[model samples]
Target: MTSFIRVVKNLLPVILLVVVASSAQGADALPSWSEGKTKQSIVAFVERVTAEGSADFVPVPERIAVFDNDGTLWAEQPMYFQLLFALDRVKVLAPQHPEWTSKEPFASLLKGDLKGALAGGEPAIMQIVMTTHSGMTTAEFDQIVRDWIATAKHPKTGQLYTKMIYQPMLELLAYLRANGFKTFIASGGGVDFMRVFSEEIYGIPPEQVIGSSGKTNFEVRGGTPLLMRLAEINFIDDKAGKPVAIHQHIGRRPIAAFGNSDGDLQMLQWTCSPPGPRFCLFVRHTDADREWAYDRASSIGRLDKGLDEALNMNWTVVDMKTDWTKVFAFEQ
Candidate 1:
């Protein structure tokens, strides 16, 4: 063999090894996540928890990871998506209820005075929700929510609400699942409303989701059994209620929790307060240019209390602008 040909053949194994190593590295667990401390911390935590015979290793069944939907998995800015659905439903049901034409909040809403309508606070908002959400079968409500989310566009962004989900989070969820973690969504959004799309959007089945809910009754309609939605409030799964709902639904405590608002404080606390190894994450909405930049002052998904506790407790806080290279899947 020629000297030059022999040299090329001798280097072939090294070149192939380099290509294989590069390919493995390129297949990152969190592609949208930048190479930073945040990513390193997450990877290290997962490794520790999943490694066989490791001190922090958790069983596959006990690898529960809970995530808040709004502002955590997706955008909640402008307003909660459920509230927007309620508003749209009100418009659709307006002609049926002529009383809304002269009502306080409804009248303002019908007149395009959104600010005035929401000025009455939770009471008025509840009124809208009960009126539009109730008096219908659970199946009917599900269809309504599904239909609305399919077509509704964010007032400002003009993009589908589901499209606003953080891209890095999708990768995180998949990564955790790959490591034998069972992911769930624990949010303050309406349970039925979220169930309409949670499985499709987040890969979380309806049974694994915990959220606020209203009373329901079994009724016979056209000789078929149906669950009729009631106006009475059954539960509010926000703030302190998050942990309560988690206990009621999930039974065991989550080893990891992810959220973006003060409403999720209790859930994160519950996850991290235990003695064993745990992970708590808070998504800081800091990318105003790419998405939104609000925390303390925002009426929707306010992160003030959670932010303070996260810093003081040393919980992982993901800085959207710095830690994430791409905010949305669409960007990639």
Candidate 2:
């Protein structure tokens, strides 16, 4: 019995070392994030805010984190996903709108010339939006968006649009929520449009999303009441408008903000301006091999002004190529 006990005790350290190593590996909350200052800053911020009895410890209810949808949570290269949806919608309805056969922008769209269609700028884009999005009940519009997103493929990558969401951001969202932070999306895309996929893809509920919107009216049709969409601008949730929408919808200032474009500058400034602990991060697209590489010169999802402000404000900027081990979840 004495000899057997001596042999068992001799192997104990090896067993303990394996268990300790496994526990340490399990402690990493953001596995998709590569080892760098960007990831370190993110983890440190969360730790400081959540540590009990610490000076920077924030209460659960006050741990609000707002994230922008396009270019932040998902890939917005080539063009915004919402714009793609709108274009596809136009094509689907083109057979009915025969007048579009000779129209300027619509004619270009029908010919699959996305560049020519958008050449007219905001006026041309708004025309497509109004034609496709308006004149339907809210429920009908919801169904249309749901159906389109389920099957639509990104033109370049050939992946479903939802599949292009950043894996690192997905880990970040789940990590924040696990730590009692309430996550909300403040996007420039249409509000009703985002609500369709926000819950399914990001685990954010419909009410937690705020975005650009058009006017709607409550009406009863054949004893059934529904909200009818209108063809007029209601609110634009980009640039300075982001902060205003945050104030109106959230009713409290966010403690952290994440985004990727000049449009998100005001939102990040609002989040980090107050005299308190806050976090602001912008995702920089720098991977040409795996994803896109564009910033200052790009028309869509421009990051010029936001990049300058992020540097001046000392906010963390995540380089997609370096800060993340993998860009898409499927890569894992």
Candidate 3:
């Protein structure tokens, strides 16, 4: 019995060594990120969480990572998906409202003058959204989104709207899943808008997407209890709304979060506020040659306060121009 016990004890150290070595090797195999502190920090954090017997080791279930959809997983310009929907809506409603032919933004939109339409600013955008998104049931709104993505093509690239997703972000999503991390899209975009293609494009299912939502009501339709999406805006999951949405929907604060604008600041702040291993990443669109690059002043995907906060917080900021080997999957 003593000899048997001695043999078992001797084998245990070897087993532990093999396990540690294997874990380290696995962590080392992460995709080749850009050479910088951001890359190093990501690798280190992942290793700490995944390493066996490590104090920071997190189980697969608890390894929740959330990412902002627009500008993080996909492109947000020439405009947001909701904005595109609103634009399409404006065109559809134009026939009924003949007066729009003479209006400022509507007149511009009708003439395919995107610049003029956008020049009217947020009020103009809200008017478009209200006209289209409101006065419809949830199912109808979802169908509208589904139909649009199915047929819509980007104006400049002439590529299907869904094809505009960032390639590196997609690879990162896949990599996280492989590492036993549960990835989610926490965006300010509409929930229904994202759910349409999130699964097909990002491999993240509808349930994993939490976003802005209109008021919903449970109604008996044909003796069946159906959830109806009302046009009344219930939440705007941007800025401060992001953290509130995260708490209400996800139930647990994300250990890792990725975002690209000031809209994501509150979410990142919330994620980092908790006492535990955490990481926050900001995707800075600095590659005008490869992708669009307008930060502080850009009307879309504005990154002013968030950029400064990222610097102060020591958050990983991904420079699209420098860090990314490729921007879009469709890019040659």
- Give each model's clash number: 0, 0, 0
* Whole-model Cα lDDT of every candidate shown, in order: 0.91, 0.92, 0.84
Give TM per candidate.
0.92, 0.92, 0.85
lDDT of 3 by residue, 1-332 (tens): 99999999999999999999898666634343566776677778887988889988988888999999988888887788668878888888778889989987789999999888878787777666656676666677788888989898887778888998888888788777877999999998888889988999999999999998777788887887767765567888889988888889889888999999999999999998758788999999998777799899998899999999999988899988877777887877
Tens-place lDDT per residue, model 1, 1-332, is: 59999999999999999998898656888989989888988998999999999999999989999999999999887888789989998889999999988997999999999999999999999989988889989988888888888999988788898887888999999899988999999999889989998888888899988999999999997999999999989999999999899989988899999999999999999999968889999999999988899999998888998999999999999999999999987773
Give a tens-digit lDDT track for model 2, residues 32-70: 899989999998999899999989999999999999999
Query: Candidate 2 has what TM-score?
Result: 0.92
Q: Candidate 3: minimum summed lDDT over ten consecutive residues — where?
A: 24-33
The residue pairs that clash in candidate 2, if any, are: none
Order of models, best lDDT first: 2, 1, 3
In model 1, what is the error at residue 2, expressed in angstroms?
28
Q: Candidate 1's error at 87, in angstroms?
A: 0.8
Q: How accurate locally is residue 304 in candidate 2, as Cα lDDT from 0 to 100? A: 98
